[model samples]
Each structure stands twice: as C-alpha cells, then as structure tokens.
Target: MKNYFKFKVLPYLLYLLINFLYFTNKKVFHHPKLKDDEAFIFVAWHGDLVSQPLNYFNKRPNGTVKTMISQSKDGEIITKVYSLFGIGAIRGSSSKGATKALISTIKEIKSGSDVAISPDGPRGPRHSFAGGVISIAQKSGAKIVILSSKPTKYWQFNSWDRFVLPKPFGRVDFYMSEPLDVTNLEFEEARDFVRNKMLLNIVS
Candidate 1:
C-alpha cells in the first residue's frame, strides 16, 4: 500500500493540487534583477512553502529550481510531488546527509541550475536562518535571492513553522528581493543578514 501510494497516488494528487493552485491564485512577480539564464540561490521561509513552490514553478518555468529535501519517509512523498512539476530534489537535511546535499547544491548552482532553499525548513526554529545557504552562496559564487509570499486569505496549520495554505481564487503577493552577494561576509553574519531581509519581505 505504501509503495502504491508513493509511486502512483501521491504524485497525481500533487500535480492536480499544484495546477489548481497555480490557475486559481493571482501571482505578482518581483524579479527585476534576475536574468533568463543566470543561476542564483533562492531562499524563503518554510512556513510560506505551501504556496511558494507552486508560484515559483509557474512563474519561472524557464529556470530549474532544485531544492534540498530530507532523506525520510515524508521527504520521499515531497520529492515525488516535486518531480511531477519538473523540479529537482537533492535528498538530505541538516540532520542527515547534509554535507553531501550542500556539496550537490553548490555543484548544481555552479553548473547553471537555479537552487531553492527554505533556510528554516524540513523543521524549523521558524524564520531562523541556517548557515548552509550562505556557504553555498559564498562557494558557488551564486547570488542569494530572498523570496516571500503573502496570501490575502489562507489557512494556517498547527505545525511548528505554522505552514500556510492560500485559499483558491485568492491573491498572493510574491516578493523577490534584489540579489545578495555573500562572498565577502563571514558565515554567521551572512546568515543573520539574510534572515532579517527575508523577515521584512515575507509575511510570517
């Protein structure tokens, strides 16, 4: 039953869900500095993921958004869902196989693939930044672009990160900050700076 659901049912359901959300919601893009082929690390808070992924996939179909997902049962389901949209996933998390995932992310960025990360994801201290993203930016020479979304109306889950689900036909404001160059900053400083910038643009 688990195999059947994972391989068959889950992907189809997510495909429908993502398409439904994309077609119904009104999206406003704020990516002036981004180019057609330039690679960058996309960062957003985990709580806003319910809508952000779909928005990014629909809005930026020309760019690939590869993200780090954990190597766990839930991650399996999430990865399957992502594949339906042509998004790529690197399996690992801060707790397990994180080093490998980080290396893969850097390589992907250097190779011209855009990467997306929820700096406070897979579990969260809720908007607190993680150092891995900054490290990727510094090493890969990819600018970090902060993304945030606010749905005019939505549901909030009881989960640790207060996961959100925007209502169908509602308006979602998607904000993308100017690209940030983290090469010169120290690890801790870069993390804090990015976190504050994301917080200001993304509604919790």
Candidate 2:
C-alpha cells in the first residue's frame, strides 16, 4: 500500500542509502566553531538535503536541529528519511498550515534547538530566497546562518534544483555563514541578505 511504503519501506531504504553515502564521504567544514548553547536557524537549499541529516548530526551529535519540510509526497518521504537520522521535520509550508508551522518552529528554536529550512523549498524557483524564513529568526531571537556546500564528486539529478547526491568516498567542503541578526531587517532587506549570502557561498 502507498501508506505502508511511505511510512515503512521508503524510510528504511533511504536510510541505508544515505548512510552509505554519508559514511563514505569525507566532510570538511569551513566555518568557525559553533557553540551548542546558541540556537540558530540555518537556511540551505533543498537539493542539499541529500546529506543534511548526517551533516547536522555529525556536526553536533545531539541531533538538536530540525527542519521545515512540505506536506507533499516528496516531503513525506524526506520526513521519514530525516527520522532515520534522529533528525525531525515539522510538516507544512507557506501555502498550507503556514501559521502553525511558524509557531511550532519558533518554539523549537526558543527551546535551544537549531532549526534549518530551505527558503527556496517545497517547490522552488531554485535557490530563490523568500522573506518568510526571516520572521522565525526575528520572533524567536535566533540568529540566521547560511548553510552551503561544495562536493568534490557528486551526482546531480535533473530535478528542478538539480538535486545532488555525493558519490561514495568524495570530499565535501561546507561553508556556514556567521550568525546574522535579522531582528530589525525589513522583509525585503532580509530576503536580499539571504540571497546574497547564497551567491557568495554557492550551495552547489
């Protein structure tokens, strides 16, 4: 059944797949030391979700980070995959259950959980930054960090964002921007700031 596959079969298979890819890949971080006490809202591109679960957990073993994924079928599958890595996803998006999602995310951040979201996510214009991602940081008092990466060897899908999957034993170079305070930024200003950061790091 479709439900069975989404809830059981898919998660198991994807878990194995990601684990193999992640465990085999060499990750190099380019950012400064990140403190555990500070909650941060990290923004990344959706395509990079391929190794995100392990990326976050491996960086901070407590698995304190969570993400906002859509309610679409792909989102369902990804949510399960995230669970397998001890990561969590808060389902829903700007077009659906936007309010509830915003509230829940704020609570998580306030509770000292680092949260990540793809500003260009769910469905995308691919790497476009939207203003909605800023409000959570403003309201929760969490600073924003732009999460980006470059892999020495990888496969790029022909999907909208050209999703990436790092080949086994490849090297991944990751870049995390300094925590940015968006508390007083206008919506447009915040969006531009995020967009510019992506341009600088080029999350591919």
Candidate 3:
C-alpha cells in the first residue's frame, strides 16, 4: 500500500499541485535566455526543487532538461513526477553510484541537453556545495548557472533541508545568477565560486 501510494498516487498529486501552483502563482524570471544548442548545468538548492522544474521547462519547453535524483524511495517518487512533467531523471546520489550518474550526465550535456542538480540534497547539511557539479561542468565544458526561487508565502518543512512549499496564489521570485565558466577553474575554486554565487542569489 505504501509503495503503491508513493510511486503512483503521490506523483499524480504532486503533478496536480505543481500545475496549480505554476499557473496560479506569479512567477518572476531572471536571466532566462540560453542558446538553444548550448548545453549548460543548472545548480539549485534542494529546497527550491518544488518549483524550479516547472519554471525551467515552461520557459524552455523545447529544450531537454535532465536532473540527477537519488536512488532512494523519495527519488523514485520524484522521478515519476518529473516524467509526468516531461522531464528526465537519472537515479543516483552523491553517496550512491554518483560516478555512473555523473558520467551519464556529462554525456547528456555534451549532446546539448540541459541538466539540473541540487548541490545539497538527498540528505544534506543544507546549502552546501559538492564537487561533483564542478566535475561535470569541467568535463562536459558546460557553463554552470545558479537558480533559486522564493515564495512570498509558504510552508517550510522541518526536514533536514527545511523543504519549502509555496502556498496557492502566492508570488514566487526566481533568481538566476550569471553563468560561471568552470572549465577553466581548478576543481576547488570552481566549487567555491559556485557555492558562494548560489548562496548569494538564493538568499538575496
């Protein structure tokens, strides 16, 4: 019963919830353009995943957006939800089969597909940066863009990452930082630069 609901019922509910929130809420976009054929990596905090996919796909419906999700139960639900939304999901995590996932993501990016990742997710210290994104950007020669969304009114779950749930009819403010070129920077430097930029955009 639990698995049925989680893998089936819950995804549809979330699909409806996201569609409602997306259509009803006032959405703000910043730095919305990316070359149609250029591949880029979007890095966002886990808390904003609820709305980020809708925001990205709605604007770039023709572009392919693939996200890295964990191999856990929650990831399964999220993968199903994303599929319903016409997005792609690669199941893995920083702690589990991340290398294979990263390799696959790099190939996708190299093929001119956009990829999204939550640097601090699947059990996070919250808002921290991981080097995996940097590796992907470097290897794939894709620019990294920091994305975030803030709602005027919302619920904050008391989970490890303090997950966010935007209220119906609320306004959501989306922020996108200037794209950073990670291909030239050393691994640590690229990671730090992205972390700071994401923190600043998301918080400010």
lDDT of 1 by residue, 1-204 (tens): 989988679878877876787579887776555776889888878888656666566557777889888898878887888877777999887888999999999889888899988888787888777788988898898998877788887888988898877778988888878889989998888888888888875556
The lDDT per prediction is: 0.81, 0.80, 0.84
Better of 1 and 2 by lDDT: 1
Candidate 2: where are CA atoms >4 Å away? Answer: none
Say which prediction, candidate 2 or candidate 3, comes out ahead on lDDT.
3
Residue-pair clashes per prediction, in order, are 0, 0, 0
Per-model TM-score on C-alpha atoms: 0.92, 0.91, 0.95
What's model 3's lDDT at 30? 70
Which candidate leads in lDDT? 3
lDDT of 2 by residue, 1-204 (tens): 989987779889978987787678788877756787898898888778775665565567774888898888878888888877777788878767788999999999978888889888877888877666888988887888877777888889999887888888988877778888888888788778877877675545
The 10-residue segment of model 2 with minimum total lDDT is 51-60
How does candidate 1 score on lDDT? 0.81
CA lDDT, candidate 2, residue 132: 67
Q: Which residue window of length 10 is worst by lDDT in model 1?
A: 50-59
Model 2, position 94: C-alpha lDDT score: 77
Runs of candidate 3 exceeding 4 Å displacement: none
lDDT of 3 by residue, 1-204 (tens): 988887889999989988887788898777656677787898889987887876776567787889999999889999999998788998888989899999999989988889999999888889877778998988888898778888887888888788888888878888776678978888898888888888764532
